[model samples]
Target chain A: MTARNLLLGLLAVLIAAPAVIGAYPLAVLILVLHYAYLGIAWNVMMGFAGLLSLGHALYVGLGAYVAAALYASFGLPALLGAIPAAIVATLAGLGIGALGFRFRVNGVYFALLTIAFAEFTRILFDHMGWTGGSSGFFLPVEHGQLNPIALRGPPVLFYYVALVMTAGAFVLARSLMRSRLGYAWLAIREDPDSAAASGVDVFRARMAAVAVSSALTSLGGVFYAFYYNNMYPEQIFSMARSIEIILAPIIGGLGTLFGPVLGSFVLTLLGEGTTGLLEHFGWAAPGAKQVIYGLALLVIVMVQPAGLWPWLAKRLRIGRDG
Target chain B: MTVYLDIVASGVLTGLVYGLMALGLSVIFGVVRVVNFAHGELTVAAMYMAWVMAGSLGVDPILTLPLIAAALFAIGYALQRHLVEPFIGRPEHEQFMLLLAVSIIVLNGLLLVFGPDARHVAVDYAYDSFELGPMLLDTVRVYAAAAAMVLALGLYLFFRFTDLGTAIRACADNLLGAQVVGLDVRRLYALTFGLGCALVGASGTLMVLMRDATPILAVQLTLLAFIVVIIGGLGSMAGALVGGVLIGVSEALAGFLLMPSLKSLFSYGLLILVLLLRPEGLMGRRA
Candidate 1:
């Protein structure tokens, strides 16, 4: 079957997923979609522009705080808060990207820059009394009601929201990968010096990638905040959170369109499965899931550096285009 | 004025330990050209090592420094030979992810083994203070700083004079050339990594004297070490020391002047400014 047909069929399955799965599984799927969405957003930079940002949590935290704070303080609906969330996150991304690119901080240094910014922002949020400081910023939960506008209510509402987000991000990433700017990004990714020599506007392409990626990720952050009904600076802005966002794209396939989604599903399922097994055995520890993630990353990078999606796709002969 | 001096004094002492931590990172980066993303976790592991030794053997934390350093050296050597060697010339992201994975494992492994409680080493001199003029200094800080300084000096001398150190430096200078000249480049890389781990591990033992040891400190300490190395210069040994002291001083002052929680603000600000103005760092040779 064609990639298009496969995607369409998958969407159909996802639309009907909540109907088949129980509440717990549905919640897990929401998390899968969440990571899938984030992975796609992050893929724009690392997968496309060859910029390794180890701290995408910066944008996630920024977006969540912006939207959650606005909703909590001004009674602003999350739907409206998304715009400002995107803007604020985009600006922050632009600033970081500009600084790094302008100063020619490539590779690991660039990654460190992202980490520094994220940690810096986390500490800043921890001290901001308006947002409840380190104590945490909490949203008022609306019980037994559906309010998609304010993003308050049941899990089904969020499940669908997350679903739409994942689909939209996948489509957006695909289009962006095929666009003229995307071509430039690919060229720059291959060789920035050669791309510059060929008049590819490497800096601008890289900057644009960061901008788009951060903006998209911020929206995911908004969804997370409203769905969870609370935001903790420590948890939300942690390097662990950033690492979780990147694992899907890295594990599935770096540059492939289907990689992030596939990776997200595999990781979240494996994580939930492990958690379930561990809980059953009374071996449930806080860091066991993270340790599993780290091992998966290690094995993937060592064994299949190209990631699972590409390898699986090639083996299955599923999609030549993907 | 005395308060300022006192802060500076304490910052310098603490900074020396931080420098020792960053020095290991610098040395590893210098030779292996692979950033040990697990640097902080390794340090945390060392801190745990010290804590365990203190609790079990009833030995002073200082006595376990050499033992922890040796253990960490072996761990680093094994890590470099098996895990890090293959990814030497790979893409930066792959290298990062590999080390990041290792870091996650090490960090979470600590959590699993020790749980989430903060572990502190109680030395007989924990509350003892030394008065140098009007400024009072904690005995623990003084001992930690002195140990770190002596270790740093030893490292400096080793790099300057020893055959192994020279071989490592040669490997760092030109990998291909070193290989062509019949040098065991891979072995040297492993040795360099071991030395780096030892430095950080020793510093970790010192660190427990001044503060509590918690797995949660892994990420922050890692970033702090990175900041020290970056501000000092990525591959410069002396730069790590200078950068560490600078960061420690700035952190102490920021804690004093602003709220204590915002101390990292200044260090990050310094990092940004350095990245912008002089990416090679103050003491580093131009990359």
Candidate 2:
């Protein structure tokens, strides 16, 4: 029940998943990993540093649009496109953090600030002509280019790429939790006043948290654009999209390393299963998945406020030290 | 010149209605100390209800306002008594999460029952406008604005003079003190929430006369309400009114001068400015 064992088991299943399953199921797995990556990144800021942002979509949209626009318009390589994507997202995060933190806009006020900024960005992008506006940006698929390094390939290749990214993010989150900055985040989360009184540079630590979290989230945005082969500001920057990203870490267990992964898998599998079942029975349920997610969040908060991962860890004795 | 005057006049009227929508949010925050993320969903639901009644019974939206408000009051009361009461004493973040859950449920549930298509209620005076001097104004806008102002004034007077209103304010100011004075704090919580829902429901009925009702509009409306609340100052009724009008006018002017899409940018920029320069809001009492 050690962390290493769990990770190894997960990797084995993922590596063998495409071989055993159909393309549709593999796509579902990719979706799960995508959310897992976002959840982990978001947790660093929200669960660790106590900055509740309901608008992480700003970074995701910014990254997606930048990468998509660059690749489509300028014919830039996708790998190199990530640099601008990450920088833009990070700088935007820093600007927002400075505006909010400097003004001492904490708690729900800070959350509102993030939502407002995201909405503003969405409207801005919706009108901008270069990024295709509401028409959407699509990366031209080079007919025969199977470039793994550039992140250009078939769905299966993208699936493995997503797995690798998710695994890498997991390691990053783990190391972060054990690092000095991670401890600082924990301190700030628990109590900013006490943490500052104890000589933790609260503002610096928070700004760093926002910067790192936003940078990581933008990578997922890049993957989303390339994997889906299109980027729509409306779809990527929607409030629902941001809510979807946060729900996984929340339901899995906020601040826990494996929580996002576990939550993502459970929610995604359940969602896919429900869709499959509905299709089989010949029923139409448009918002069923969201209904299920909402119920899951409510039940978790009401029944196990700390999240399912902590309770599961205790019962199963996995990561007992954690 | 006339065009600019028309925009400003319409903006002021719309601002009054916006303030009315935000009044319930401010009241709930002031009395219950919980931010209801589902407030917009409640408003949308009320709009749909008004729409249905207007369509079926052949009555005006104004006529169905009382009925929609009553129904929303019942729904809000039950939700507060059952779903929200347990978490009232928890941390602010936990309460926030609970309300967010409520928002998701209500929003998607509405989407489930009513498809994603936008529905509008047609009235006799839907497109009718009257000219005043060199400016023209929509009749519905003027009526909605008047109703909103009247409701705001009524709420302010009720809070000032009524015993139940005094008890609610007492609870807001000092939870323990209110309880020690033998006030039914739990009932008051439910009542406050119900009253807040009723106010929002009234606004929704008025809104259906002017705009289309879509499930997705709930989030936008919720954000708009928050903007109004923040601009006016949180937990202040008067602030909500002033803030709403200010935002409405600014948005109209922005749309006229810049582009229509940038109007939200103007409102958000105003919010950030107020947060940095005067977080207490224009009419909010210094705490």
Where does candidate 2 chain A have its weakest 10-residue lDDT segment?
A313-322
Q: For residues A224-312, what per-residue lDDT tens digits would candidate 1 score against the true structure?
A: 99988888999899888999999999999998899999999999998888889999999878888888888999999999999999898
- For B48-96, candidate 2 gives per-residue lDDT tens digits of 9988898889899988888888998898899899989999889777888
**Which residue pairs clash in candidate 1?**
none
In model 1, the number of clashes is 0
Which regions in candidate 1 have their CA more than 4 angstroms from the true location? Answer: B280-287
* lDDT per residue as tens, model 1, B10-42: 999899999999999888887888878999999
DockQ of candidate 1 is 0.69
Candidate 2 at B4: error in angstroms? 2.4
Each model's TM-score? 0.97, 0.96
Question: Candidate 2: misplaced stretches above 4 Å?
Answer: A320-322, B278-287
lDDT of each: 0.89, 0.88
True-vs-predicted CA distance for residue B181, candidate 1, Å: 1.7
Candidate whose DockQ is highest:
1
